[model samples]
Target: MADISLLYPKGKEVSTMTLTEESINDLSVDYIVESLTKDIYEKNSIKKILTNLTCDIDVINYRADVFEDILNFPELRDGLVELLKKLEDLRELEKFNKDGDASSLWQLINRLREIDGYVLCITMLKNILNTIPIKSQGLLDLKQTIEDIYNNGGFDILKKDIDETMAKAQNLKSVTIGVNLDSVLKPKNAGVISLNNFEITNSGILKNFMGFTGSKEELNSDEKVLSSHKLHPANPSLTRMKFGSAQQGANTNVHIDTSGSATGDDPLSQSLKKVVTDILKRMVKSIKATLQKYVNISGYSLVGLMPEIIFYIRFAELVDKMKEKNLPVCKPLAVPDDRVAYGEDIYNIKLAIKRTKGEEFDIIGNDITFDDEQRIYVMTGPNRGGKTTFTQAVGHCFLLAQAGIYVPATKFNYSPVDNIYTHFPADENDTVDLGRLGEESKRLSDIFKVATDKSLLLLNESLATTNVAEGVFIAKDVIKAMAYLGVRSVFNTHMHELAHHLDEYNSDDSYRSKVQSLVTGMKDGHRSFKCEIAPPQGVSYAKDIAEKYGVTYDQIKKNIDNR
Candidate 1:
């Protein structure tokens, strides 16, 4: 079983359903994911979790419940967000431990640090989870997991042993190395003579120099303190060893190394790492097995949940903001396939986000459904009358609902589609080889090949690139194909004539679905942007547009007269 996942039920490791690229672009799905994960570390992974959709009802419910619990408990969301940062630290530690060139002792030290942090993460997880009244299967499983890892993992004993091991390994604060010179006064080799917890201050060096010179007075004073340790073995101006020091005169500053470390790959550093590793090897061995034993139980498995946990916590923040604006954000009821897919006061989420950002504008939400009576909609409206927007809104509803995020509606009762196929306007560049019509035809053929009754199809101004008569002819066949297949669809088009043949399309008893017409409404010659089931008002829409834009003959005459 998945130790705990905010995105799936137990034992379901992969998601069968996916939102196609066209569907993703048509509905601006990335905008939603990006908004949730913006300015966050590991944002790409969090986005992957949100986009990795599942078709199983159990999984959807499992995720939806987890989202609700996170939303309800502010403490849980805040605590998890902070914990993900520590998880990221553990990941960085793992990377450090994987360095091929680092000494074995170096890797061991970092491994200990990682497992040490891992222990704290689990303890923190248990403390936070235990305090929340989490009823969701996902969170409950997480709580149980923390308890299991804590109670059974000998954490108290482990922590004690780890601390002792770290102290033993890090007991020395400084090292004194003696470099052996070769024939021409060049340093040939180096080794550590002693390791000291006490600082070897410049005053002590000055005191030693005074003693070498037979001075009676003590040399210890604040003025003796200086900067970085010298690269030269001795001060050249003061002694024969300093004058004969490496190529540069003693007291010349050592140049900083380019490879992100002050020590660089100089002879001293190379030798120190080797000697230090050998020296510390015995001490780190005390906790080596302890760290290795819990590697599987305590590390990456819990780390895997970071992305999913972030997905919930980040979206929980968005949900809270949506609530502040009185925008409807409700957990959708994933109903049975036979039941109606219904939503009321449902506006596109893009508008809700804008409203939350303090953008003032009118957003009209419409009540919509796909039932036995209207299994598919043939939507027609005036130019820019929100046909495409509404079509995308429907796609967003289903996508967000299935992904276990709250839908943008007062109420949403939906039958989850296995997958959604979008037939939005393809790029002109994509149509270059086949021509627009041919390209569209091929895409439609591909959709039909895979789309089943359980799938949803969103067609936005499809086939409208060709002439009206040709577009209409092909569109009718497409709608008929959809009706015959019994799949739920919204075919929003500029070909108003396509909306007229729905009854004829429905009368064929061989087909399993009823097709109906939907139009974006108008009131007093102005666009209301509300959608409703109605016959295509082809001529009436033009008249309303003409009147609204002062383009009607009477209005033109009145304008002339006023001028």
Candidate 2:
């Protein structure tokens, strides 16, 4: 359980099923994730959330609201990011407590420190939220919880007790020792002594030993006890006592012991160890008593939200980056029940990422309007004319829009799709198992079995690996299925004949959305990469390629004359 969930709405269980890898690859989803999560902290965790993206309308709307709040109020996002940075690993605490492993006093102290950090984080965030405005419903709930916890009388009392206990623990800075030893360098007894502001200096001892030869008025006070022998007359004087030195001659080895603390943690005498242990025992008991009441609070549960916080912050950063470049990004309006999707000035987001990485290029955005009239599009264009790029762009727009982040478009509005099905070209290895055409047909069949009228299908150069006659024959049937199924689709292909026969499929009245031909255009005999609602210009495409390579009749004649 998380203290705050930025991804999900309160009390809503996110569905488990997600778009398949085939669909993700067809839409270039992995590329999108990589681009968004770049330069983000805990990037792996962020990627996990992105990889498991949901297509649920409510979930998407929930995320969109949270992202909107973050984008609107940057200070709040920054504060939350900073607060999340202080959270220690909660799993470690759970594991330690689960095993009841308090074998050492240091472990107990560390646990207490972690708890103290959590309390401080919560209190500081509560105070900071007072100045920052939060609009998201989920965040408002979290804020209310924090306020309630802080205003409760029991919480204030517990906090005060913790502060006082820590102050006492901090005051126990140094320990004094009293040791009793036998004649054989063995300890018999030891105890902690009250430590004063004891100073070891030369002049103080000398002044006490040889009283100052000053005026009689200065010496009239009580005489100081100069020697230990005088102070303890009954005990024998051991002022000149000398112990055996560990130093050996020139050939002797003097290995330095580099381990243990300077405070005699690994003392050579057992009596000294006993004294340190006694102090630690007392300190641990006091700390345990202070923390006992707060142990079950599960404050570490807050750390579980660190990764989610990073996810939102990182995407917000990318949104800012897109804004800095003067690119168009808009908040999408989701109409889940409408069963229609459309966007104006929609551009390929993957291209935007490349351009941001210093790739020099210009982008021309295309507008799409899919409704009951034109529900499926048979897109055809010349090679390298951005047919696949444009198709993938539509899918990317939907994914980004529903994720609640700013999409790379000027305007976007769409109904949420229940799922996305893709029929891109198969991998080379897939052909080994079932030849290219067989595999493509099988995958298409699989998609139809799962896809519904509310699904989105993106097909890129599908069914073109076989001969033209065979390809067109199979593509015609596929287009018929799309029309009858009434799903939104972009079937970009080299088979211009298939795109030319859209009227044959649209004549059927039972079809929910009419099929239309969408061609990638040419301007001034150059590839424009601009998609338009028109018939495929196959003859024009061939002529442009011939003239570009000096293969036209006039160009060939001129080349021969020059030679």
Query: How large is the C-alpha RMSD of every model relative to the true structure?
Result: 6.2, 9.7
Query: Which residue pairs in candidate 2 collide?
Result: none
Clashes of each: 2, 0
- In candidate 1, the residue pairs with backbone N, CA or C atoms under 3 Å apart (3 or more residues apart, or in different chains) clash, namely 236-242, 236-243
Model 1 per-residue lDDT tens digits across residues 87-119:
877766666656788767666666666667777
Q: What TM-score goes with each of the models?
A: 0.86, 0.78
Q: Write the per-residue lDDT of candidate 2 for residues 242-361, one digit (tens) a residue.
A: 322221111111111111112222222222333344456767788888888887765667777777777777788777777777778888878765568778888888887887777878
The global C-alpha lDDT for each of the candidates, from Candidate 1 onward, is 0.75, 0.70
User: What C-alpha lDDT does candidate 1 achieve relative to the native structure?
Assistant: 0.75
Model 1 CA lDDT for position 171: 62
Score candidate 1 by TM-score against the native. Answer: 0.86
